[model samples]
Structures are given as structure tokens and as C-alpha cells.
Target chain A: MAESEYILEVKNLCQHFTSGRGRKKLTVKAVDDVTFSVRRAETFGLVGESGCGKTTTGRTVIRLYNPTSGQMLFDGRDIAGRMNRKLREYLTSNIAMIFQDPIESLNPKMTIEEIVGEGLKVRGNRNKEDIRRQVVQMLNKVGLVEEHATRYPHEFSGGQRQRIGIARAIITNPKMVIADEPVSALDVSVQAQVINLLNDLKEEMGLTILFIAHNLSVVKYFSDRIGVMYYGHLVEVAKGDDLYQKPLHPYTRALLSAIPEPNPLTERTRVRIDYVPERDHDYSLEHPSMVEVEPEHFVYCSPSELERYREIIQNA
Target chain B: MIYDRNNLPEELLNLPASDFEALYQEDIKDEKFQTKPVGFFKDAAIRLTKSKVSIIAFIIIGIIIILAVVVPPLSPYGFNDQNISAKYLPPKMPIVEKLGIMDGTRVLKNRKVSGLSDTDRYPEGSIIEYFNVVTAKGQEMCDVRVDAYMLAGMPDGEYHWFGTDYLGRDLLTRLFKGARISLLIAFFSVLTNVFIGVVYGAISGYYGGKVDIILTHFAEVLDGMPYIVVTILFMILFGSGMVSIILALTITGWIGTSRLIRAQFYRFKGREYVLAARTLGVPDRTLIFRHILPNCVGPLITRAMIAIPGAIFSESFLAYLGLGIKPPNPSIGVLLSDGQSVLLQYPYQTVFPAILISVLMIAFNLFSNGLRDALDPTKRGEE
Candidate 1:
């Protein structure tokens, strides 16, 4: 792949936290050696269960949490752990985040205008009129009116609040947006509306998105390529449709089987596959690393398993 | 049949395509009726006015303030003025005298004259008469008659409203002046405490980890100290005055506010909104001041209002113990202490100051309660 084709490429990213005190000190690997690349203007979905470090990875990429050790290349420049003011400012302005909970993501004390225009103000847009105009434009684009700008977040419904969150994220015209389970908190009906709005905005703004969620179905619908994580490790990466049809990793297969089908016959007949690390592989003998099994497909497996996976793909 | 139906259906054929173009056009018109955004303080103020008890408390406080400012200077008698002749005079109502309801005049007879000459003692306009009087035991006695100048230049007989203290100082005037001193101390001490506490707490809370640990431990240590003991120590060290009392109150007083602010900061600092602001490249100063601090304002204001009454009470307690304001300055505490000594003899002295203190405390408490409810975000929009 050409270097400029990928807007963000993270290599060997690690974030470890120290817990306990003194002699009993322990390091919990929140994100361990995760590597992935997001192509320009393409959605890269990250799927994982609770405590699997999908959110951690998104945050670390945006420098919300400093990576313990890694290389993050944004716009072909290494931004991982770079503490300079200019680089920090550039990264923040270029990348924005949509948090999981809309109600908590917006300051209740601030009106919609201040919340949405905060980014512009931070980036040095001092003109009040200009900020107001831009905020109104963004709000309207997200299906809100000008009068809504003056109201507090508490007045809006969950769907409207999420739209405000979306407006705030995109008002600065960021090149990349990290949406961390943006619709997980909304009702099923509202979830579809929010997802559609995100999809529309993505196309209109040409934004590269790192979409993180535990819902595999939503991830499949929204992403071009998907990465499956388990216990702080990215176990598989493949095209969205390909991964759903033929999951390479055991964990991915297990996660896919958990999704209930609409047809009762298929739902009842579906067999759940559980991936336990102890029974899965002999890591003591040969440790697994992410390796390419096909042209654009990657899986975390040892030499023997990798050969098995390749043969299985060839047979299919 | 089809040909006949086509000929008859002119109404159906005349129907043109209905235009729905307006529906597709964006509804960008401004709202016909819009409400101006209500600010945090304005909303709180509206809520505050809704409570009747709070309004009554507010009025009481206002009246006290007016009396504190306007009453003392208008009194005929100075706070320290002493008239030995009027030392133990019971209150005599001037209105009653004018209406002839009572004759309050007192003529002292059968009393021995003093050694000082009558001409030298009495002022120029005085009328002094010497008379020989017979007592019940048939002993001869000399009596002196002198007309006394009472309140409003009334001679001898009149009512002394609120009476007088042991030294013949007007009780009403002293009470008003004492209120001024007490209120001044409360205001200053609360201001100092809140200023120090907020700054300390904001810094401690915003910069967590090592800075938080150190500062929190320091606050805990200060909190562990006995309040009255510390106050007494400060009084002894700095000597008794307004400055010393305020310093003593503030030293430990701010710890509560600081802790409250610090706890509030901790709760808000981890909130997603604050994190969102941080991710938006907002400077640390703006994040602390604009984002985090403003949310803490409601609780902080309520806490500060409650602290004012605590300060006033502390001042009075210290003054009552004789370690507060000096004698002539007349704090409520000082008045109470003096009144308590002669409480059995002249109960009015103790009763009057006690009533004032009770009213002040109740008013402050009621007002603070209203403020808390008004500023609470959770209670907003509820009746």
C-alpha cells in the first residue's frame, strides 16, 4: 500500500496500568501490542466485549491516554507520545471523539451553542458571529434548528442530544472521528436514526472513522473493514462482509454466534462456540502473532493454526 | 361503458398534480415565539423568589441591616453615656406622661445632701431647692429637689424604651451597634474563608495525584484540630480584636469549604464533558475555570451561604467568652456576656440581645436553605 493512502497507522501500541501497592504491584495490560491502519476516508470498526480494551485503543489513538510504547502515524507523521504543544494542538484539531453516553458527553451547564462552538473557539476563532453562524449551520445539518442552540442538554431527548454530540464533533471539520459506541445508549429505533446520521455525515465530510462497538451487527453495517479484539488483543482483521461470512479466529466465531437471528428456527438451532485461551492454543510452546492469511485478511495464530486457517480459506 | 365513463369523469381529468415542493424545502424559518435563554443565576433567582419563607427571611435580614445602619446614629444617648442619677430608674413611658395616663415625676425627699455645694453641682438652668423634711421616726432630714433631663428633653418622668444597661447606656442603641459589628465580622470572615478555600480546593482537585495527595492530607490535618481550641489559641496569640477573631475563624473554617469544593471537583473532573473539553484542545486554565468550576458553582454558593451564619455564631460565641471584641465596641457576644452577669437583676438586658441573636440565626438559616434548593440543578423545573 502507498504510505499516503493510509491516514492513521498504529504499530505495537501498548498501554499498561500499575495496580496495587509496593511488593504486590501488578501491571494490567489494558492494550497490548495492538496494530492497525485506517485508510483515508474509510471506516475501521473495532469490536469487542466489555473490558476488552476497544475503548482504550480508540482513546490511545487520539492521545487521550498516552501509549506506554508504540508508534502512531497520523497524516504520515509519528504522533504517539509526542508532548509538544504544536503537535498536540494539531492532533486535537484534526481528530475529534464522540463518546458512548450522549447525556454525560455534553456539559449540562453549557448551552448547545457553547458546547458545539467550543472547538472553534479553542482553535482561535474569536469572532462571535462567525462562531454562531458555523454552530447554527452544523446544528441544522444534524437535523436541529437555531432555537435549539440556546437550550440546555437536559431539554433535548436522547436522539437529539446525540445529534448535538455529533454536531460538536464535526463542527471543527476534523479529518478523523473516533465514535466510541455512539448509539449503544439510545433506544433501538433511535439507534438507527443516529447511525444513519453518522453515515450521512461521514460521506458529506469525507471523514475517516474509527467506529468502536460491542455490537457486531452494527459494526458490520457501518464499517468497511473490522478488527475483533479479545482481552486487549486484536485477534482478527478482515473485510466486513468476509469476516462475518468466514470468521478466522475462534473468538470472532464465538462473538458472531451470540448475535440472535430474527428467524426463531435459526436462533434456536444456532450453536454458541466459546473460546477459552487454555483450551484454544498452546501459547507456552509457540506464541501467536497477527499474521496475514489472505491478501487483506489477518488473524492472531501460531504457525500450525495459521496453516490450518489458510487451508480452510483455500477450501472455501 | 368505458367510453361513457371517460366522458362523464371531467372532475377526475381536471385534477392537476398536487405540488409537494414546500414539504421538501428546509423549514429554516426562525421560531415565531422564542424564549430568551435563562442563565444559571437567573433561573436560581426565579426559584428563590417562589419560596415564601425565603422571601420573609430576606425581608427580615433587610430590616436588620437597615436598623444596623440607621438606628445607632439617631439615638439620643451614646453607647457609653452614664448618668448615675438614672442608674436604676424603671422605664417611664413618655407617651403615657403626655396623655396624663401616668405621672412619672420622682421627687427625692428625706435624703441627705451630698458634700458638693448645690450651686457648683447643678448647671445654670437647673432649679435646686433645699427643704427640711421630717421622717417617720421624728428625725430631721435635709432634701434636695432637682429637675432631671430625660430622653427628648422631657423632665424626669418618661418611658425609656428598651430601658438602659448597668451604665445607663441606651439598650436599643447598643443592640443596633452590636449587630453592625457582628455582621461585619461574619461577612469578612466568610469572605476570607471562601476565597482561600475555593482557590485551595480548585487547585488541589484539578491537579490530582501527588498534588492532591499532599494538599488533601494537609486539609485533613487542619480538620482534625478542635475548632474552639484553635480559635482560643489564635485569640491568645493575636490578642482579642476583629482581626484576630476573623483570623481564628478562617483558619479552620475554610477547611470545610475546601473539602466540599475538592469533592465536587473530583466528581466533575472525571465526567465525560470535562474529558470532551480536554480533548478539544482547551487549555488547562479554561477547562478548570470555564468547564469544571462553573458546574461546581451551585453547590459552592450554597455552602458559602451556610458558612456565613456559622461565622457569625462563632464570633458571638467568642465574644460571649470575653475573647472577642473589646468592651466599648459592643458586639452581640459582649452584650450577652455583660447582660448575663446582671441577668437576675435586669432581665431585659439578657432578653433583648438573646432575641436579636435568635432572630438573626433563624433568618440566616432560612435564607441558606432557600438558596440551596434554588441552586440545586436536580430540583430545577420542579415546583
Candidate 2:
């Protein structure tokens, strides 16, 4: 694989949400110093449990909640700088996000046409006919027909609304898309349909996707590269197959072991690993940071543990 | 029925390959909606009509508004036309006259029984009857029933459906004319209140943080002003005209709407659709007007409708305090104040105006209640 282009580069990104003032002030480090990158035309899956800041990382990358600190470079443009009209324009024109909840993400009052065409309208496409034409085409690409355009979001079922959301995000033809658990809210049967549609679109348009989901199996099936986050920090990053087969980090192992086996007999005896950060690592002795254990495989560990991870890779 | 996989039953083993088919669809598409598209207002309208009480109230209001606009010009007796001789006539409708109710006859208590037949004191056909004669200290006295119209010597063919007030002005014409003026004030005040409230609240709630804090403090300061004092100041500045009264009503009146709108904005601003819009780089103006504001419209419209009756009542209260529309330009309040002075002598004068205002208030209130239920999306299709 000679592809060397990185479409988006995020370095030490932090997103902290704070409320109140002075004595009563409180802060939540939702996304802490997390770093990763997405290559052009590649799918990067971010997997984490609830409240692990995977979603926060995706939102911060799209500049939804402005970064508290850290730097983000998209196509070599500094996006983590101060938010101004020009930066906002630049960010919106390139990157679009698909929210998690299908019902919550869509505007209930707007027609499907208006909801999907809104992206185009924001980009200065004011011709009603042109917008309608493009919107219908995008809807069809997502397996919805032209007739559904005039209908409100509430009329459609969950899966259809999600498809409409996908249409809204990709209609602008952005180089990168942040899909935040797009199919987690859908039924199992509908989930495959949406994933396949996304795969086809990604291939058709050469789109780089930052796919965020808690579902390990879905990410395993969809991602070219995978990053595992735990409690506001990324603990492992590797190819999809390598991460699934040889999870180097303790948290990654615990997450992989948690996937229930299909066979009743094997499932009954399946070993589930529990990871306690304090017991798993001696952070007092040395600070733990990201270290490359193999080519294209990075694990978060201190100097001593990094030696062990490198040995494990060399043995395999 | 249990067959081993290694040695399956002949029929099961021989099952045709053609029998197997996939239920999983490769592509999913939504079915076309069979019903016509129902927009926000259309949905609200459908729900509103389902409420029987609201429909009745709406019709009553429509008729009253139509009459308020149509009655004053059509009625023969001008609202201010006064004839001293025709003072204090009872309602003398020609049709209801034969029915013996409101037949223009009134009982004259403590009259000399001998004077019942005196033509000069009681004109021809003026005396209806007399009864209950009592000898009070050798003076024979009785309650004498006489035709009030004839007692006042009004023309034979003439009639006053609501009768005349102490000023001898036609009550029906004056009451409806007052309704017209009162309705105008309510409508104008409510429109301005909603407009100012929506803009102010949108700015405060959408921009939140310091902008919200400063705007809220300003509104609180304004709200602290004593309402009556503000009205008094406005009256002094502008001379108690409709413009002055409407301005007074609006000064603090819009604060409620602003608060309501502000709360609605705060609730909706954090919704995912709004976040999505922000991520899409939608300008703040569009986000405020299109995304967040439309959701608030359901409550905003309901609030505006409810504000009408409140404004009308406030105007009447001002008029009651002798600050209503300038004299001779009748409002319900002015008519009411006039009727109050002669309440004992002419109860009909007070009764008619009182009944009209009461009906107007109740109608508006019921109609607005229906509108609230209708506009609530959660209550859609509910009876």
C-alpha cells in the first residue's frame, strides 16, 4: 500500500466542557489529549464504551464543540485555531457529521427535501430547481425515492431517517465525513443495509470516513484501521485484523474478550478480561504514552511495557 | 421429528434447492405516504375543530367581531345622539314588545293611585296597569305600571333594542362601537407584544451566556416598574388616546411573551437538529428564525391568542380608572363606567355592557385554550 496521503490529522485534541463559575465551577474532560489520523479514501473506526469520549473526539474533529486546546490539521489547514466566520466556512464546506440518533438528529418540522438540501443551500446553492434535483438524486442514492422529499421527518421510520441523514451529509460531496454511530440506533436487519450503502458510497466517491461506534463487530467489519479509546484516552491503534487478533493493550483485550461467542458451549466457557487501570499498569514509576510496537500498530505504554509489547510482536 | 444431521430423513434430505429463498432485502426503501401532507398549521386546525367547545367559542367570537364592525353604522340612533326628553327608556323592541317582555313598560313605585288615569301625567296608552294600593296616612298610593317609551314620548314606530342609557344614546350602537374600539386595542397590543417579545427572546436565548445575562437583567429591570405608574405616565404623555393606552399595555405586557419565548429557545437550542445546523455552518440568523423559532411557534401563537383577552381586560381596567379612550369615543370600559353611575335607576344600562364584555372574554379564553391544545404536537389527533 503506497498511499501516503493523510486527509485529516488530529494531534493531542482536547475537548473539556465546564459549567458554573469560581467556587462552584466544574469541568469534564470528555475528550482528553486524544490523537489519530485518517488517510485519504480510508475508513478509521473509533470504538469505545459509553462516556469514553469517542463521540467527543468525532464532534471536536468536525469543530461542533470547539476544542478546549490542541491542534487539528485537515488537508494541511489549521482547524484548531480560533473560530471565526472564515474558519467556520472552511470547516463546514469540507467535513459533515451524521449524528447518532436518527430521530433526534433530523428536524421534525422540515420536509425531507429541505432537511437534505439544507447543506447545499448553506454552500450558496440558491437555485430551488437545482437543489431539488440534487436532493432527489442524493435521496435515490440512499435508497429513498423522489416522492418522499415533500414529507416531514416524522412520517418516515428510523432506518429511512438515518438514510436521509446520510444523504444530507454526503450531498455536499465533502472529502471527509464523520459518522457518529450512524447505525447503532437502527434495527439489526436495517443496520446491514445502511452499512452496505455507506461502503458503496465511500467507494464510489473516494470519501474518507471517521466512523465512531461502540459496536465492536460492526467496526470490525467496516473499518480499514481501528482506534480503541478508554476513559478519554486512546489506548490502541492498529489495522482491523491485527487489533481483533492481537489486542496489545489490556483495555483492548478486555473489550475484545467481552464480545459474546455464538456457540453455547464455547460462550459458556469464554474468558472475559477485566481491566483496572491502577492494577494493570504502574504509572507512578513512569508516565504511559503512545509507542509504536510494530509497523502500523501503536500501543499506549511506558518504556518497560513498550519493550514487552515489541517482544510479543517480534515473537508472532 | 428429530433427525440426525449425519443421517437425515429422506424427505428432509430430498428437499428441493428451489425451496430456499432469502428474506433479507438487498436494498430498503420507504413506501410512499398515502395521505396528503399536513403542514403545521393545517394539523393544528384539524385538531382545533375537533374540540366542540372551541368551535362554538370561535363562532361566537366571529359573530361578535362582525357585529362590532357592522352594528354602529347600521343602527339608527347614533352612539352619542342624546335627546333629554327620551332619557331612561326601557328596551322597546317592536317584536318582543307584543311578547310582553321588554315591552317598554316599567313599574312606577309610590305613585298616587288617583293619578293613574291622569292623561297629562300618564300619556295615552302609557299606563299599563296599577295594583297594590295602600292608604299611607290618608294618601292613597299604589305601584303604577306604565309604558316607559310613551312616558318619554318617543315616536310610535321607533324602537331601541338595548334601550337608551342615562344620556339617551342608543345602548346597542354604543356597546358594539365600544366593542370595536376595545377589540382594536387588544389586537394591536397583542401583535406588537408578540413581535417585540419574539425578537428580544430569540436574541437572548439563541446567543445565551453574557448576551443572555445582560438581556435578562434589562428585562427584569423593566418588569420591576409598577404597571399602573407606567400606564399613568403614558396617559400623561399622550393624553389617554388609543395609541397611548396600547403603548401602556405593551410596555410590560410583552415581558411575559419574552419570558415564554426565552424559555422555549433555551429548551430547543440544545436539541440535536440545532447542533446539526450549527455544524452545517448555518448562519445564526437562519438558525434562530428557521430551526429553533419554528418549534417555539406552537407556544408563541397560543400565547398571543391568550394575550388578547388579557389586553382587553387591561384596557377596560384603565378605562375604569378613568384612563380609557378619550370621552365620546366609546369603549366597553367607557360604556361600563357611564352605566355604573345610574346603575340603580337603569339596571339594563349596566346589564347589557356587562354581558357583552363577559361573553367576549369567555369566548377569547375558550378559543385560545383550544388553540393551545391544537398547536401541541403531542396532543395531535386527541379529542
Candidate 3:
């Protein structure tokens, strides 16, 4: 594949944290050897249960949290480990992130103009008029009026604040964005509105996004490709429709089964399969690694389980 | 999906022109619009004005400041000027005398002629009389010639509005001068402490881990020292003066504000906006000072206001203990100490300084309370 095809690539990313003191020290492997890539102008959705390292993976890829060991290539340049001033500046200008909680994500004391224009100011734009012009333009693009520029974040609703958050993220015209559960804290109606707005912005700006969420249905609706994470490991990766239609991993099947169907008959009769890793997989002998079951569909399983999974796909 | 007016859909083009005009018509009401936005400080000031008690306190403080500035120069008697004859004179208001509220005394301008003729010894213009004098040791009687030239203007006698002190200095002038020194020390000490505390605390709290740990420990060690003992040590080493007293108070004064600011910084540091600023490439210095510090202003201001009374009280206490302002230059504390010896004979000496200190402390505390309530956004609607 051409290097320009993908905007961001992560290979074997690891992030560990140590807690407690002296003899009672503990190391938590928050993100353990996760690998993924986001192609240009495509949304790569990472779905997982809470505390399964999906958010941590997004943060580490953006370099908000330093990776213990990994190679994160943004535009074919390595930017994972210790960064120099030039590389940091490059990363800051080229990539941005949208946090989960809309209310807490914005500074309560700052006006909408300052919050959105902060990036330009930090990048050394001294002209106030130019900054305001760009900020107003971005605000209008995010479905906010010019009057909202001077208002504080506390005055806005959750959905409106998220739009403000989005405006702030893309004001510098970054190439890629990492949206960490941006709609999880919003109302159901507002969630759809924010998601649609994000989709529209992605198309208009030609932005590649790493959308991290715990909701399987939302991920299926928004992403072109999806990766399922369980216990700090990426267990499966496939095209969004393909993964939902034909899931090979037991964990993926369980996750898909949990999504509530709209039809009354199916909703009443659907039986959710419980996936217990200990009961299902006998990984004591050979630890499972990610293996390709078919073209563009990968699963975490041993050689024997891989053969079984492939036979099941072939039979179906 | 581009919709040009000329290329409108067939169904929309078939609609009548009158219907299109009717769809846009509605009531147009005239209303004034806001030309500018209100800032935080402006909003706080507006809210502060609504509280009646705070306004009264503000006016009282204003009067005291005016008195401190204007009264000292206009007074006929200097703060240190003395007359032994006028010692322990009772208070007499000039306005009361002019109003004829009390009878004025008349003195005879001649000396008592016991062994010689009255005209030869009195020199024709002098009045002889026996005068009573009281000393710290005992009371005595003395014969003196009262010259009319010395008693011309004061038909009754010299008037002392707040009466004269033991040194026969005008108590009113001394009180005003004392207020000037006390208020200045409080103002400058609080300003110094807040400036140092905010900077130190912001740096310590913004950068956590080893830096925070070391700085916090250092602050704790300083806080552990007894304030008065440290103040006395500073006084002994540097000697008692305005600079020394201010230094003594500031040494430990900044600890409280620094701790307060540190906690606030710690709380705001984890907030997502701060993280967003960091990811946006804002420098650490800008993030700490510009982004994080402004949010802590309300609490900082309230804390500083409350600190003033404490500073004033400390200065007065030190002066009362003879380690404050020296004797000749009057401090409230110095006046109180001076009055303590003659308190049984003359209660007015102690009463005036006591009332002034109490009024000042009460006013400052009430004003601070009002400021805290006014600046709190949660309390806005309650008013």
C-alpha cells in the first residue's frame, strides 16, 4: 500500500501506570500492545466495554498520554516516543481531540471566542481581528450564531457545548481527529444530532477520525471499519457491516447480540449470549495472537481455534 | 442539493405570489439590544452594590480614610505638642460653647497679694489666685498670677474635643494619626502576602509530583512556626519599625493564601479545559497563570479582604506590647497602652482608641462577607 493512503498508523502501542508506594506497588497495563490504523478521510471506530482501554488507546495515539513502547506514524513520520520541539509543534497543528464530557471539556471561565481561538493564539497568531474572523467562521460552520461568541460555556446546553467543543477542535484545520466518546454524555435525541453534525463536518473538511465509543450500534452507524477491544487487547477487526453480519469471535458475537433490535418479535425472542473468556477459550497452552481468518477480517485465537473459526465461516 | 431561485421545483413555482408574501408576515416589535457584554468584574460590582450593609461599611471606611488624610493638617494642635497646665483637661466642644449649652467660666487676672500690696505685686493687669495641680504621686496647691493677655480668646478656657492626654497633646489629632499608620500597615502587608502567595501556590499546584511535594513540605514547615514568636524574633533582630512589623506579619501571612491557591490550582488542573489548553500547545506558564489562575479570583479576593482585619489586629497587639510603633508616634496600640495607666482617673483615654479599632475590624469583616456572597455565581439568583 502507498504511504499516503493512511494518515495515522499505530504499531504495538503500550501504556502502563504504577500506583501505591514501596512494597505495595502495582502496575496496571492500561493499554497492552494495541495496533490499528486510520486511512485518510475514513472513520475507524473502536468499540469496547467501559475501562477496556479504548479511550486510553485514543489518548495515547494522540500523545496526550505517553506510550510506554510503540511507533505512532502520522503522515509516515514516527511521533510516538520522546518528541522534540519541532515534532511536538507539528503534531499539535496537524491533530486534535474531542473529549467525552462536553460540560467538563470546556473552560467555564472563558468566552466561546477565547476557547475556540486558543489554538491560533498558542500557535502565535497575534492579530486579534484575524483570530476573531476565523473563530466566527468556525462557529457558524458548527451551527452556532455570531452572538454566541461572547457567551460562556455554562450558558449553553449539552449539545450546544459539544458543538462548541467541535468548533474548537477543528479551528486549526487539523488533518485527523480523535473523538473519545463525544456523545456518551448527551441525551438520545441530542446524541443523534451531534453524531450527524460530526459526520457532516468529517465530509466537509475531509478529516480522518478515530471514533472511540462503547455503544456498538452507534459505532456500526458511524464507522466504515470497526475494531472490538476486550481486556486491553484488540480482539477483532473487520469492515463495519461485515463484522456485524458475520462475527467470528465469541466476544464480538456476544457484543452484537446485546444490541436491542427494534422489531417487537425479535426484541422479545432474542437471547443474549454471555462470553466468558475463561470458559470459552483454553489459552493456557498457547496464548492467542491476532490472526487473519479471511481478507481484512482478523481475530484473536490460537491455531486450533483459528482453524475452527475458518471452517465455521466456510460452512456458513 | 443546491437550490437556486430560478431553478425552484415545479410544485413551489406554481404557488401564488400573495401566499409567499403572507408566509413571511408577522408582528415587528421595537426592542433595545445590548451593545456590549458584561464582564465578570463588572457583574460582581453590580451585585455588590445591591447589598445595603456592605454599602454602609464602604461609606464608613471612606469617612475614616478622609479623616486620616484631611484632619491631621487642619488641626490647630500638633500630635506631640504639650502644655503642662492643660494636663487632664475635660472634653469641651467649641460648637457647644458657641451654642450657649453650658455656662463658661471666668478667670480673675491677678496674683494673690499676701505679703505685699495688690497693685504693686500684681502689676495692675495680673490676677492672683490659688490653682490646684494633680501629679502621679499626689495633688498640690500653688499660687500664681493669671495674666489677662494669656486668657483673652479662651474666655472659659482652652477646649479639648476629646480631652488632652497625660502629655497634654490633642487626643483627636493623635487618634487620626494612629489610624493612618494602622490602616497602612494592614493594606501593604495584605498586598505583599497575596502577591507572593498567589505566585508560589500557582507554581506549586500546577506542577504536581516531586515539585509539588517539595514545595508543599516547605510551606508546611513555615506554617508550623508560632506566628507571634516569629514576629517577636523578627522585631528583636530587625528592631521595631514599620518595615519590621510589616515583614513579621508577611512571613507567615502568605502561607494561608498560598495553601488556598494551591488547592484551587490542584482542583482546576485536572479539569478538562486545562487539558484541552495543554493539548492546544499553550505553554505551561500561560496555562498556569492565564488559564487556571483567573478562575480562583473570587476566593482569592475574599480571602485577602478577610486578612486585613487580622493584619491590623496584629499590629495593634504588637504596639500594645511595646514592640509596635514607638511612643512619640501614636499608634492605636500605643494610645491604648498609655491610657491603661490613667484608666481609673480618665476612662476617655482608653475609650476612644478602643471604639475606633472595634469599628474598623467590624467594618472590614462585614465587607469581606458581602464580597464573598456577591462574587459567588451560585448566590446570584438568591439576591
State which candidate has the highest TM-score.
Answer: 2
Give the DockQ (2 decimals) of all models: 0.25, 0.44, 0.24
- Predicted candidate 3 versus true structure: per-residue lDDT over A213-256, tens digit per residue: 99887898999999999988899999898798779899998888
Q: Candidate 2: what is its chain A TM-score?
A: 0.97
Question: Per-residue lDDT for B17-43 in model 1, tens only?
Answer: 773243333332334225566777888
- Better model by lDDT: candidate 1 vs candidate 2: 2
Looking at candidate 3 chain A, the ten consecutive residues that score lowest on lDDT are A261-270
Winner by DockQ: 2
True contacts kept of each: 0.48, 0.55, 0.39
User: Lowest-scoring 10 consecutive residues by lDDT in candidate 1 chain A?
Assistant: A261-270
Kindly list the per-residue Cα lDDT of model 2 for residues A196-239, writing each as its tens digit. Answer: 99999999999999999999999999999999999999999999
Scored against the true structure, residue B343 in model 1 reaches a CA lDDT of 83
Please estimate how well model 1 matches the true structure, expressed as its whole-model Cα lDDT. Answer: 0.83
DockQ of 1: 0.25
For candidate 2, lDDT tens digit of each residue in B1-383?
Answer: 11123433567657898999977756666667888888778889988888999999999999999999899999988889998888788888878789898788898999998877788888888888889999998999999888888888887877888888777888889999999999999999999999999999999998899999999999999999898988898889889888888999999988899999899999999888888888888999999999989998889988998889888888888998999999788999888888898898888888988999999999999998999898997876455
The candidate maximizing lDDT is 2
Which pairs of residues collide in model 3? B109-B126, B109-B127, B110-B126, B110-B127, B110-B128, B111-B127, B111-B128, B112-B128
Which residue ranges in model 1 land beyond 4 Å of their true spot? A1-3, B1-39, B77-160, B225-241
lDDT of 2: 0.89
